[model samples]
Every structure is written in C-alpha cells, then in structure tokens.
Target chain A: MATNSLPKADLTSSGRPVFLQNEIECSILSSVDLECDDIPNFPLLKSGLLVLTTHRLLWLPDNSSSSSSSSAAAVALPLSFLTHIFSTKKSVKTLFHSPRVRFQASLDSSKSVVMTVVMRGKGDTDAFLAKFWENWRARAWENDVQTQTQAGVGSSSVSGSGPGSGSGGFYTREGAVRMVGVSGILRKEQEMWESTDKSLQEAFQDLNALMSKAKEMVILAEKMRQKLLSGSNSKSSATNDDEVGSKEEMQDWLLSVGIVSPVTKESAGALYHQQLSRQLADYVRIPLERAGGMINLIDVYCLFNRARGTELISPDDLLRACSLWEKFDVPVMLRKFDSGVMVIQNKSHSDEEVFARIKALVTNPDTLRTGISASDAAMTLGIAPGMAKEHLLTAESKGLLCRDISPDGFRFYINLFPEINTDDVYLVKDYGIYNTWVRVASASRLE
Target chain B: MRRRPGIGGLQTAAAARDQYRLVGENVAKIRTDMMKEQLATFRTQLEEFARKHKNDIRKNPAFRSQFHEMCAKVGVDPLASNKGFWAELLGIGDFYYELGVQIVEICLATRPHNGGLINLQELCILLRQRKSDREAVSEDDCLRAISKLKVLGSGFEVISVGKKKLVRSVPTELNKDHNEILELAQAQGFVTVEEVERRFSWTSGRAIDALDTLLDEGLAMIDDGHRDGKRRYWFPCVSSNSTPVADT
Candidate 1:
C-alpha cells in the first residue's frame, strides 16, 4: 500500500464514493498512474478510474478485468494535504513522451516526495491538468472541512478556522479577514455576495469566463444548500408552514441542480457507460427502496436524470447502463415484462413474494367481491400504479390472477380461471378460489 | 215487338207471350247489376276490417291471443311463444349495444391514445347508436356478430359477463389504448388537468371538468394527486362504452 502512493478512497456498497454529507464529485479520469519514486514498496496502481471530489482524489480499479474480483478497494488522497504542483515542462523531450504531471507534498515531518501522474489513456490531458491545478489552488477541501467543523459546532455559532490554515502563510495581507459573532456572519455574507457579483460580472464578460466559473457556481449552490439545511434545523419552530414548505421546495431544487461529480465522456472516455452504470447502480438503490424494491425503467430514467440535475442522460444511455449491471455484482437487475415493458428490480425481489401477497389480497372477501384495480394493488403494495400494474400483470401471466373488464372498470381477481373447472363453471367446489369468489361475487350481485 | 211479329196464330200467340216474358227478364237482369254494387261496397268494408285486424293480431297481445284462439277454432296453427323466437324477432338491435361495448373494449385495449383519435370518434358514434336503442342488447348476439366479423375474430377474446348476462368479447386493439391510458394515468398519480387538456386538446378547465364527470360517473377514479397546487386525477380503469349510467 505504501508503494502505491496513489491516494485511497472509500466506496459505498454499490461502488459510489461515500461522499461526506456535503462533499460532491467534480471530475473523473481513467487509466491514470499516481507514482511516487521515493516510496519503494508502493503498489503500481495503474490504469484505474480517478475521481476528483471537493474533499479528496479517489482512485478505483478498472472493472473490465478479473482483478475486480479482488476485494472492492479504493484509494483516496485528501486534497487538504496538497502543497505545490509543478507545471508541465514543454521541452522537446517532454513533447515526445506521454503527458504527465508532477506534484510535491510532505506526507510526514520526516520527508516529502515528488509524485508523478502518468496519463496513459486517450483523454484531454491539458484540460485535466488545468482542472487539477484549479482544484488544487481553489482549496475547496479547506472550505469543506471548515463547513464540516462549523456543522459540528451545533446551531449556536458560525465562526471556525478552515482545516488548511496551516498554509495560510501564503495568503497576502489583503486576503486575511478575522470573523467573529453576528457582525462577522453579516460581513462574511457581504463578502460572499461581492465575490458572487464579481464572478457574475466577469462571467458576462465572455463565454470562456462563464465556463471557468461553472465549478464555482456549483460550489456556491452546495454552500447555499448547506446553509439552508443548518438554518432550517436551527430555526425549526420560528418558520411558518408556508415558508417551510417553500424552503423545502427550494432545497429540493438546489439539491437537484447538479451532481457534483457527473461521469463525463471527458473523464471516463471509452469506459463512460461502465462507470455510469456503476453510478446508476448506486443511485437507484434509494429510489428502488422507496418503490418497494422495483421501478419502471422510465421511472428510473426520470429519477436518475432528476438526481443528476443538468446532466440528463438519454433513455438509450440509461438502457445501456442498466444492461451493464449484469456483469457487476450490483444488487439491482433489469427485468422485461411479458408486455415488453422494462423495469429495474432488486435482485432479491421475487415475483413469488409479490404474487403471494397479491394472492392474499385478492382472496380476501372484500377484495374478492370488489376486485382490486391497479390502484388498489398499488395502495396495498406501496408502489406506483404503473409498477403495481406490472406486478398484477406478472401475476396474471403466471395464472395466479385474472382480469375483469366491466362497466365499472378493469380489475384483477384471484385466478378463478384456474380454480373454476371449465367443465362446470357453476360447480363451485369447496376450498378453492373459485368457490370463494362465487360466494363473494354472488353476495354482491344479490345486494 | 219482335214477339208480336213472330206470332202467326192463336197458338203462336201463346209462344209470343213467352218470348216477351224472356225479354222482360233481360231488363230485370240489368237492374239487378245496378243494385248489386251496394253489396260489393259492403264486402270491401268487411275486407278492410280483416286486414286491420291482421296487424292488430301481431301487435296487441290481447288481439294476438284472441286471434290465436280464433285461429285454433278455425283450425290454423298459431306462432310459438318462446325466448328464442322473441330474440329472433327483436333482430340485431338487441345485441348491438353489447357488440358496441365489446368493440370499444377491444379498441381501448389495442391502441391507447392521448384521446381524440379519429377511430375513437367512429367508435363513440357506434356506441352511441347502440346505447340509444330502447331494447337492451344481449351479450350472445354481440358475441355472435363479433365472431362473424373477420377482422375482429383474431384480435378479440370473449370475457364472461356478469350473471344473467352474455359473455363480452373484447378486441385486442383496445389493449393498446388501455396500456397507453394506463401509462399516462400512472405517470400522474391522478390524471392532471394539463394531461387531460393535452390528451383531449380541450380548454384547460373544461378538460378537468370532463375528467371530474368521468370520475363521478365511475368511468374513472382518482388514485392520488400531487401535493403541489396542481390536481392530478387517476383512473381506476376505462368504462365500458356501451354501459348505461344506471348500470354503474
């Protein structure tokens, strides 16, 4: 591990970065080499996917190979420790060689080492280098840690020095500002507004300027969301319901405006779908749980696109991404109904289980008499009617249920078809769905 | 005068008297022809009465029963009274409504549209005609007609109707419409005012009002609505096009 000087990362069970509460992904790269010549036993850690977040640089192994069978491990480098980055030397020798970046940092008091990042994959090396430089210089991690500590300070105070203050010696006298109490909070807000105004004015100056400020805008949105969350929690009783509702809506809007780390063609390149596939696997878990372990592909598309904010993926992309889940050890799988509608369902979600429940529901005297519509099933199943329809249809296909179309509406009944002997429809034998249905249906008809 | 000329002797005079009597008889025959016209008129009136009574025999149950008794008295067979014959005399109108219902069901199941499809108008017209008829359509007649229609034969499947009713067969084409409507309704917890408007291309408020009518009539149902100000309407399912409001 020491030999693999590449920073390590923590991944969720589904392979997504276990982002700090407010931390977000910024950019991604593939087939990168983080080499420290000073460390002898460092792991080679070659050709892995690198994700840059607000707080850390994360690396994950390429999953296309059998090596993925190795324990799901990731490496991360806390952006807080980054010191100086060396600019690329564009000599004839460097021009002929693979694009590389060199950075120097001290891991301990005893020594500091120069790390070389070799870009072996086909990507915009220049763009990556520029972003890398910007991220390093922006000191976003310091702000994140500061916010994190402020969050830890409870609802009472807002003053705290950022974690990277050790490097504050580099700040010019004009950059220094001492903040304390309510006045300090107001002054900070003022400074933030002036900075935002300056950036807005600069952004209007040119398209290139706006593009440069895009990351800053995302950061600003994140900060606003965090501030709102903390504010809402602290003043929980002070705000009225209407204001709270609007704030909640605003919070939702802000939360969905961007995915701090969108897997882009620029980052993952040829492996875009694979990485996107993994990210989707991680993303769908919540919605899947909410939907009771399954969801329509179209629904997932909508939710996933919503969660991704502006980076809306196409249906084709979503389909391809979902298809890739088969090769991975993901918990969700794609399912196609007999009706040809596709859905995403948890692997553990068994139709037999849903069928058993539906069987119970339809066999109930009330449901047996009224017959359950898709909505009724949806209500009982705690799912969308669309999803419930799929389940009901599946049950229908399995001959576990049958459909009734009448002047009233379409509904599903326990498959009295199987229970009713075609030879004698009126012959409702004891101890069968047919007999039960007849008893209920007859009573209703009589009524 | 000819008889007098023919008479030559006293005996001949007797023969002449007989000839004159014959001529007088011919004149009387002409008078009789004039007088017989009244009898012919009376006979014509009797014939009209018989014709009117024939119609009465078919329509008026009492007349029919009396006529049947008279026919029995007169040694003529009376028409049989039974369910089968009654159904036959009622013709196809009795089954038209049921057929129309099945057609709508098939169309709805086969191709789901937002609404306002040209085919839907045609189907609605057909259903309206079936519904307007005073006679209740029998399910069997509808099923029979559907079975006979070549185009619908493959696509339609018969579903047993309620007790005492004939089985209603739906066309597979309606499945498509059902699916589309279901999908649209599902996407919205309830069919939204916007969705109704979009589907029907009706005025905003009108679409919502119409949807409410559909809801109230039990043709559709509201499953859920958005918490946001916008109201969503969910349909339990599409209603049978030919079903009377009272049936629901």
Candidate 2:
C-alpha cells in the first residue's frame, strides 16, 4: 500500500504550501483521481485534490477522507523532467467524461503518460489547463536554479572588484569616485535613481510580465542587502556614525522585501487560500520567532502582502487560510482575543510565558517607578508597538498586570491589587510584594 | 419459687423510664428560663445605663461638642434637637453591637497598661477634638482606633435602643509590653509626640512625657530626619547603619 503514488502536496500551518524559494503554484482541482492501468499494486490515488505548480504536479486528498494513508503522501513531479506536453484533444467522449488533459513526459529513460485534471468545482477548468501548459513550458524552477548560480557568481565577482574600481555609477558618467561632500550626495542619489528606475519600468509592464520581473527584484534586493553588509564590514574602521546608521536602515528595508517567491491567487487557482495559507505559515516563522511567538494577524497581512508585491491577497482569503490551520499539523495557530483582535501565534505560544515576561518587565525598579507603555514594551519585547499593546492587554486580562490610563498614555504596571491587603491598605507587610511596590513607588515620588 | 414473677425488675424499669422523662423536661425548661433571663438582663442593663447617663450625656459640653463635630464630619446636621436624632441619623441601632464591641476591646486592651479605658463618651470627645484640630481625623483613622481596641478582648459591649446609646469599657489583661508598643509606633510612622497622641488618643502632656522617657532610655530617639516640619522618630529595632526609615 505504501508503494502506490499520488500527485499530492503538503500545506503549511497557515494552509500555504512549503514551496521552494522560487517555485510558485499554478492551478488547483478538487475531487480528482490519479489512475494508471499498467501497475497492479499502484494504490488507488482516489478522488483527491490536485495542484499544479510552476515546478511540480501536486495532489492533495479531498477534505472528507484526508486522514487516510493516501492523503499522508504528497508526491511531486519535477517539471524539469517533462519532455513534452500533448495538447488536449476535443472529442465527443472527452465532453462526456470529466475534462482531462493528458501529457507525455520522460520518467528516467522511458516515456510515461500523466493526465491532469479538471474536476471543476466552482472554478475555470480550461483556464487552469492552459496555465498548467504555460507553467510547464516556462520552466520557472530552472530559472530559479540559474538565478541562484548567477547570484553566487555575481557576488564573488562584485566582491573581487574593490570599491575604488567597482564604482561605476549607472546614473552618471563618474568614472572617478570621491568620498565626501557633493560627490557623496550625487552617488547616493544615483544609486537610488537607478534602482527606482528599474522597479518603475518593471511595474509598468503587464501583470504576466511582472512575474519574471519579480525574480529580478528579488535578486536586486539580495544584492543590495549583500552590498550593505559588505560595505559595513569594509568601512567599519573609516565609516562615520551617520553613514553606518543609514546603512543599517537600508539593510532593514532590503531584508524585509527578501521573500523570493510569494504564492498568488492567479498561480494557486481554486486552492488559492489553501496554498496561500501554507505559504503564509512558512513566511511567519521568522517574524513569529522575532516577536516572541506571536504576531497580530493584521501585521502578518501587511507583511505578507508587501512581500508578495503585486499579487496581494484579500483579508478574507488570509482569514480563511488561517481558519484551516486546525486541519493541518502545523506548528502555528490562529488566535483571537476577547477584544476581537486576531493574531497568528506559534502553537506553543503560552499566555503563562508571556505573562511571566510581562511580570518581570513591569516589576523592574525603573519600570515600577515609571510604568511601561506599549511602545516601551514593544522595544523591550522586540515586536511591533501594536502587537505589544495586545500582549499587555492579554496580560492585563489574566491579572498579571494592570493598566493606568492617563493624559500621557495608557501604561501597564505589575498588578499589586491581588497582592495588596485591601483589608489593610496602609499595612505594607515587610515580606510581601506589596511592600516592594510601595518602596519602589515611593522612591519615584521622592525623585 | 421458679414460677414467681420478679418485682425488682418491673419496679426498676418503671423508675428508669420516669427518671428519663423527668430529665428531658427539666432540660427544656432550663433552656427556656435561661433565654428569658438573658433577655431581661440585657434590657434592664440597657435601660439603667441609659437612665443614669441621660442627663450627663445631654448636659456635658464635651459630649455635645463631640457629637456635633462627628455629625458635621459625617455630613449630617448636629443641631436637629430631637433626642433620638443622632441614633436614627447614624443608623447606630443596626451597628450598635459592632461599635460597642470595638469600644470595649480598645478600652480593655489599652487599660491593662494603665492607659485609661476610653468609654463611648471619651472616644466621641477625642474624635471631636481631632475634628476641631487643624489636621482633621478621617473616618479611616477612627475605624483603625476601633480595630486596634478589638484585639484586646472577646466581647466588647454596646447598647443602642431608641435615641439612647451607651458604651461601657471592660479592660482585659492582654496589654502589649513597652518594646512591642514602641515597635508598632515606629512601624506606623508616628514620629512626633503629637502624632503618637493623635493616633492613640494620648493627652499632649502624656505623649511628650512618654517620648522623653523612650528617648532618655535610648529605646527610641528623635532622628534628625524632618520633612515639612514633621520630625521622624526612629526605633532602636531598625539598625541606624542600615537604610534610613523612609516616610512611606
């Protein structure tokens, strides 16, 4: 039973695929079968969901019986191996049966037939078949491989040429480079001008054209990041403080846009949300790790859509994809607060842990004296200010902390209410948390 | 002889049954009588105390002044002129038991140390005095005084009926030693003689005399720590080498 094969793909925690850095999904179909006559032991890859991507032919199981052994196996057929794609023939029999597109490809040394697939459920099947052919011929996976090699070679070559000689301004005829004053401003302007010019030109092209341009944009971002890194390294001795600051800012901007392949609705088709959801799950890993295991859904949407560039998904699509996380064995989950604010958090993200950290933060002598605002918590927690506010609010609800709303802003303090002896408000016992708070608060008042 | 019935068994069983019924009736009658006697005693004591103190309560300048002050502080009119007016206004009838218990406890606790038992009349006078003082006494302060009093004894008696209210102090033998009192005073941040007097209802002369004695004996001292003219008194329990005792 294990020897049988099916065209299937795995979904990420956010219901998106674990796609290669440059591999993009192309089409999706529900209630499809992978039938073959030659092999007797070939397990019936019964009515499952099939996905076509730029690089692989993927099949996923139907929603009803997804728990079966067949669904557990997701197989991919590399487009690089496909030698030919036979066009869909129009016949009376074809019209009667489910719409199927057959293609001939070389598996190892022999020619084999693989058919795909239109079990059209609320989607355009002919359109998907057309895209399937286009993606196969385009050979996006090959392009990614070639670009990676090109990037490797380019970096080595660019580094080999020292700063003095490599300074060929694409915007100006400055064969000679200067380090200060007007020349510095002119150089910075020229660099920005050329990059902006390239991106602008790419943006003006047709949507299909941008798919290829997106690769260049990714390459450019990577190059900029590398340049920033190397520049900081080489100029560490001579670089002034302001130059270093700007370099760091530029590096951050470049790093944010570094996602090479973002799944789009056009590519993922009817399984748009599911595939997008999976991709989102993979994407959120780094951000979630940096945010201490949780991130607001709105922030994820902005980051995801920004990384996606032109193929931004709707909020509804993002939500549906998040809602589907329960069905997959992903490491992250979608959490909704009582305030109706939603967030994507690691499955292991515990309130106890966050509350403990918050408790520590607010109880610090300095923080106790001057309560922490959302921004202050954001800086300390290394997360967005908005996200920090949500965490503080969560901690507040759990009674780990309390809020003080004042003209200055809303701030949080370690909750002393529970520890306080309301029966004796003035009685600060020497061996209790309330005593410590009173001491700290009094010290601040003196100051 | 074998066939004859035994008179000893029959007579003994009959006597035992009679004794059991007699005992049960006696128990019930005693419970009823005890309850009636307790009620009568409480009523008689209340009435006698009220009758004895009624003229003094009305004519006493200090009592009238204190009552007026309390009424003013609590936002009620003191000059209502009705006899039971204060009782009705303050809902003392409902709270009389609790207030009486508080007074008795305080008086008992403080009196064992030769601190005069503060009756309801004296408590009222002290509160009134504080109200008239530049620094007015808060309700919380009054309640604190009452609470401290309760720690002395199990039963603190108060009687409230119609417009008449009487409080009698019953001192107990559970007075704290001088060391403990000094510690409590320091912990409460009662530094100056005036502060101690205000907190414990000590006369100005008595508070000063005690402070002088404590300082002379070196058990306590007036530290040089003064803020806004309020000198902070320090107890020897807290090491002078450690951090200074802060106001808070």
Candidate 3:
C-alpha cells in the first residue's frame, strides 16, 4: 500500500484536466496504466484513462471503475521531461501479452526512470504509441516557453517606450528621437505610419504569410486588451470620460476575438460528446448565472459557438452534448419544457424562486391594475422574454398567477382564484395578495 | 512614384496610386482574416481563463454589462419583422403573427359568453382547438400577438383586475371605478354596494354609479337570489369559476 509520488494534475469541475496555455488534447485511451519497475515501492498504478496531449500525458482514474476509490487522483507527466520513447516490438511474445509502450523520462534533474505504459483496454495501442512519439518529438512545451519569453519581451518593450496612451499607442514612435516641436511630432507620426504600412504589406503578401503572422496579431490584440484593462484600473481618476469610453469600445472588439482548443471529433474521437458535455458545463456557468440560473439551449448554442469562433458545432452535436450531461456529475442539467423548448439550467435553480418573483410582480399596484405581460416579467427577472413567459406559465399552473386575454393583449395577475371565498361571493380576506390588490384597486378609484 | 503634370504622367501617377490602394485594401482584408482566426484561437484560452475567474469577472459589473451589450447587439427581434433571417430561420415571427390572427378569431367567437373579455388561458385553449395544426400556442405568444393588435386601436388592450387578466376586445373604456368594482367582485364573483362603499370609503352614489355602469355594459348581472336583503352585483367577467353561459 505505497502512496503515489507523481505530481497531481488539476482537474476542472467536470473532471477534465486543466490544459496549459497552448496545450491541445491529441488522443485518449481508457484502462491504461503507467508502471515504473526501476523504482522500489512504486505506487500501484492501476488501469485508468490515459490522455495524451501535445505537452503532457495525463492519467485520470477511470470514473466508472474507480467510483468508490476517492483517493486515486489524476496525475500528469510532462512530455518535455521525456528523454526517449522505445518503439513497440512486433513479435509472437508481444502478441500473447497486452500491448505496452516503454519510455525513459527524467522524474527530476538528477533522477531518470524507465516507465512502461500498459494498455489493457480495447484501444489502438500502436496509435497511442505513435502519438506518444509524435508528441515527444514535437516538443510543444518548448514552444510555450519561447512564447512566454517573447511575450514578456514584447510587453516590456511596449511599457518601456512610454506610458501607454490606452489603445491609441499603436502610433507610438518607439526608437525615434523624442520629438519636441510640432513639425518634429508630425515627422514622427509620418515615420510611424510608413513603418505600419510596410509591415501590413509584408504580412499580407499571401494567406500563408498572414497565417504565420496570425499568432503575432493575436498577441498584439491581447497586449492591447491588457493595456486597456490596466489603463482603466490605474488611471481611472485621471482619464476623461471620452478616453475611457473609447478604450471600452476597443476592449469590446478585442474581447470577442475568439476561443481555442475546442473538443472536436477529430481529436477526442469516441469521447467527443462526453468531453463536449463537460466543456459546455464549464462554459455555461457564467452565462447561466447572468441569465438567472437558466438559459435557452438555443441561446447557449449561439453564445458557445460564438465564443468558439470557427469551431462551430452543429445543433445536433449541441443536443447530444447536452443530453450527455445526465451521465456526468456536472452541476447543470438540460431540461425540456412541455412546449418542447429546451433549456440548460443550474441544478439549484428552483421554480419557486421564479414563482416568487412573478408573485411579487403581479402584486405590484401598477401590475395588479394592468397585469404583467411576458416582456414585463422578462424585464423584471432579467431573463429572455420567452423564458420569462415559460416561468409565468409555470406560475399559472401552480395557481400563483392567472392570465387575462383581451383586446389589450395577454397579461398575468396574481392568482386571486384560490383566495376567493366561494361559499360567500362577497367575502374579502383580511390579509393576502387579494386583499392588498383590492386595496390598491379601490385607492385608484378615488384618484 | 511622384506626382506629374503631363496627361501621360498623370495617367501613370493615377495607375500607381490605384496599385498602392489595391495592395492596401488587400492587406486590410488579410489582416482582418488573420485577426478573426487568431481571436478564435485566443477565445478558447480566454474563455477557459474567464471560467476559472468567473466569480471575479462576474463581480466586475462592467464585464457583465459589456457581455450583455454584445448579446443585445447580435440579438435579432424575431417579432420586428415577418420576413428576415430570423423569420426565415425559425418562422417564429410568422408563428406569433398567425397566432395573433387566430387569437382574434377565438376572441370574436367566444365574445358572446365572455363578452369580449376572455381569460388568456381560455383564449389559448380555444385558439388551439380551432387550429388543425394545434401548434403550441402559449399564453405568452397570445400576449405578444395581442400587444401587436394595439395598433388596430385602443379597443384591443389587456386590462387587469384583481389577480386575473380579462381581455376586453370591445372599445368600451373601463375606468378606475369600474376596475375597482370588478376586482372587488373577484373575491366572491360578486360584490354588494355596502362592501364596495366600505372598502373604498366611497359614498353610495359613487359606488352605485360604477355598479350601474358595469350592469349596463352587460358585464354584470343582478343576483338578488341570496337570502340577505342586499342585491349582489355579480361580474361574470371577473368571476373565475362561474361560466357566463347561464347569463348569456
């Protein structure tokens, strides 16, 4: 009963591994184990779900098989630390045994061990090994380190030029002599413009060139966003309203730029829908909160796709992903109303909360007199009009509200049906919404 | 290339300028495409980062507001037109517009018993029953379409009394006094002069005037069958359970 000493990987709320900045999941295999016989008292690395990414190999406990073993946590091994991967040998003896891929990796600066990955499940062992080799050779983690230093240099040079003028620093004359007179300032502006024009021309020579420069443009946009964010926070007292407003506009444009590493069928294969379901659960939390714990499935599709940029998922895929939520322990659920409207809602979202809000709305003197339309409830509840209507209907079904149909249009009022004393047609209760409504109605009469 | 004076020189200058402009436009287009691709890639990481710091981002009212602002900007009001991308895609605008016509038909058909004042729930049911498609027409849909009917005239507008909305298709304006009496009558499906006066502290004249007005409008019925000496001004329009079938 030896404890594992491997570094643990951080998992998302839905148990997906937290990926590095540019790390992408390349392949996945279930019921795989990583064993190091070279080290004594090695932890019992049992069959688990092995995820191969560009930067690391992540092993997560098979959720189905290890449901009761809470102690078996996910562990990660950086591909960067790998020294060599031994190719699988084709032999009669290998055919008799479970396919295994052995690799030599440095556990630390001073220690190295030969780790064997035992593939026990019905998976393409050869394919996993090929990817293991590809990822190890790709050296994706090196690229990340390079980008980090590059971004560091880029930002430092940006701040080093002068105090940023918010998003208007694009025309910043970095190395030119500090201009004094207006003519010198104009010359500096002209030179900056020419350099910008020349760079734009060079970047646009062809699509391939532009594709290569795309990463730089993204970094530039991110830098601008950071600049604006910091500018607003730091210079809030000194910035004029117009400058702040323009900076906000720039931030909006940059904020919508795009998302990365969407779970595609090409990458995740059989796990596409499951991973998508988890990714969706994580993505929808903010929007669900902003939408008051419930959002239309169609709306989520639109927002999720918009955030994902070109990696647009089909509505069918979206539905499959949503339906898969039931199998996971995610906090969100997909609900279909009686009218065939699909919605994703937080598990904690209660109809009673909405009902209570509707009740409060219907009892308002103005609402009591005029009733509330779906749009009225929508406005008050900060939800879509359609969703608000569904809530209003649910409230009506619960006898919390009643509808009025007229030439004026459809509206809802607090349900006075249950409060009425049917035994005595003229009886008015001493307390309740009905009584309060009656008082408001009568008071309006005198006015 | 520099500016020239001769006609041929001018032509060459114009051609050079045109070439430069074409390159500039090409670069702009390419830059935009690159930006979109880059943003798409960046968006995934940004969204993940945002999710991790969701609480902090949510607490930043400005961020939430900006997100909502974007949503608003992209949101198309399907009801705004019957022929547009949204209309063609979902046909929701047409659905509601057609539902509105069906609603009118139902109101007209049920006008006799309900007296142009039908409950929204009943209207939806009747509208559904009349349609062969029986397309799911919700009270909300009916409300949205009915609101659109306001353009027809003030005759069609939703009026609320007590805890119920009774659609009044007729042009008659039910003033505050009439609404008060209707709401008071809701509790017991009827109200007497004594109750109205006591509730409003109104003189008998004000109470009786409103009651008589409701009676003349065919909205109220005289229910003197009670053992008590007082006559109950029964508002069939405001009553939840008592069908107007008997009175009509």
Which numbered prediction scores highest in TM-score against the true structure?
A: 3
TM-score against truth, every candidate: 0.45, 0.44, 0.51
Query: What is candidate 3's lDDT per residue for A1-447, written digit by digit as tens?
Result: 233456789998987888887776777787788799877877666788788888899988767443536457888998987888887789999988989999898877877889999988887777777777877886767767776877776576456433222222343544656665434544554565465556545544543443455445445545544444444454333325354445356335324533345666645666778878888888888878875676656446546754553244655678888988888889999877654456788987778666767777777667777777654555466553445666888888888888887643457778887888889868898998788888989997999
Candidate 3: regions farther than 4 A off: A1-3, A64-71, A122-124, A156-217, A220-258, A352-447, B1-248
Tens-place lDDT per residue, model 1, A106-156, is 776566788787877777788777767766776765665665554344222
Which of candidates 1 and 3 reaches a greater lDDT? 3
Q: What tens digits encode model 3's per-residue C-alpha lDDT throughout B41-66?
A: 33333333333333333332222323
Sorted on lDDT, highest at the top, how do the candidates line up? 3, 1, 2
lDDT of 2 by residue, A323-437 (tens): 8777766788887654345667787766676677777777766676667765455546554344466688888888888888754346677888887677877777896667777
TM-score of chain B of each: 0.21, 0.26, 0.37
Of the two candidates 1 and 2, the one with more favorable lDDT, higher being better, is 1
Question: What TM-scores does chain A show, candidate by candidate in order?
Answer: 0.61, 0.61, 0.68
- How accurate locally, in lDDT, is each candidate? 0.53, 0.51, 0.61
Estimate, for each residue in B1-248, the C-alpha lDDT of model 1 and write its tens digit: 33445336656877766765554444333222322332223223222322333333333221232232222221121221122454466533323322433353334333323222223234445434423333444444455544433221232333222222212122221122333444455453456767656774644333443454345434465555446767556564523221111101
Candidate 1 CAPRI grade = incorrect
Q: After superposition, how far is residue A10 of candidate 3 from its true place, in Å?
A: 0.9
Interface RMSD of 1: 41.5
